[model samples]
Target: MTPLHRVGSALAIAVALSLVTACTAPAPTPSPTPTIDDSAANTPPPTPAESVAPAGGSDPTCETIIPAATVEDFESLGWSAEQDDFRVGATIIDGGLQCVWADHAGPATDHVQIFGWAPIEQDAAYDAQDNLVGEGWVREDQPDGVYITENPETTISTDENGYGMTYLFGDGWVKVADTKQGLLLVVWGD
Candidate 1:
């Protein structure tokens, strides 16, 4: 065959080989779209921040890390500690402790989360603050609790739809406090 014909044949063979390879390839699996049902619509989503397990040799627990919020603690702060309105989520992660508390009785949803770790080598406080900021909480000079002198301002109302205005907790995130264990951080939000 002429040189031109041989070149054309080689090109045709290459195209045919590619076509066969493509046709024989397995079809890609389609990823299912995540769906939220009506029941799940009201369920609060997990915090968007990726919680890092505690590092170093320190190990913390919910009991050791979370501060006690007594009935008086709630009442004095203008929050009812009644079980009906109080909900808590606490867990140990990466040898560290994380605890969250919320009063769901009101029309709005607000929560207080405390994180504790020992040794205080890394910037856990800064990380917590960054996580809260990333979650869209606006920073304030002081949390409403700080300004309360006597009784907390009562603004409770029946939330027929159960949707109330969200308020960030504490003066701000990264409330780093020194304790016997190490560093403690308190963050509050909806």
Candidate 2:
């Protein structure tokens, strides 16, 4: 045989051997499927001794003021509750319960703050409505009281306004909700 033919034959044999080796190689073991622990999500919030009352209004615990289902819904959205004294417009009324739910890992504007004052006098409720109106908030009269809001229409999450503030004045209660990141606050008073 010619020298060139022998070299060509050797190259063909090497290529055939490589193909056979690759075909016989063992298949790699796949990583075990990861298990997610969702126990925290199912856990319920603590229950306090008594229901919340505005009289002398010692600041109510987060558990007392917010419902378990509400808190769970917020938690599902990666938000957690923080209880603190909150400011509404230009006033910080005493003896009110404030609960703010926010994604601590996210931006500062991603939060929902709710301030509720019960057993409020009529005069104070009117004063709060007036204060919000003076700050360019629109007022709508409800059968029980008034509903005042910075933006009357629903806000989109990407809107430049960033947040919306709403005040609900009822018979003996007043609630202020400052919401951003597309959160909705619905409060009912007894």
lDDT of 2: 0.57
Show how many residue pairs clash in every candidate, following the order shown.
Answer: 5, 0
Residues 1-190 of candidate 2: C-alpha lDDT, one tens digit per residue: 8999999999999999999999999899996532223343244423323233446735455544545566676677777767666345756766665676667676676445453444467887778778878877788786746767675455432223444655667677666655321112233233
Model 1 TM-score relative to the real fold: 0.22
Q: List the residue pairs that clash in candidate 1.
A: 54-94, 142-171, 143-170, 143-171, 169-188
Q: What lDDT is obtained when candidate 1 is compared to the true structure?
A: 0.33
lDDT, residue 2, candidate 2: 98
Candidate 1: clashing residue pairs, number: 5
lDDT of 1 by residue, 103-165 (tens): 435456434322333322135434543454454433333533211111113223212332222
lDDT values for all models: 0.33, 0.57
lDDT score, candidate 2, position 21 = 91
Model 1, position 40: C-alpha lDDT score? 24
User: TM-scores of the models, in the given order?
Assistant: 0.22, 0.53
Off by over 4 Å in 2: 1-59, 76-78, 105-119, 152-163, 179-189
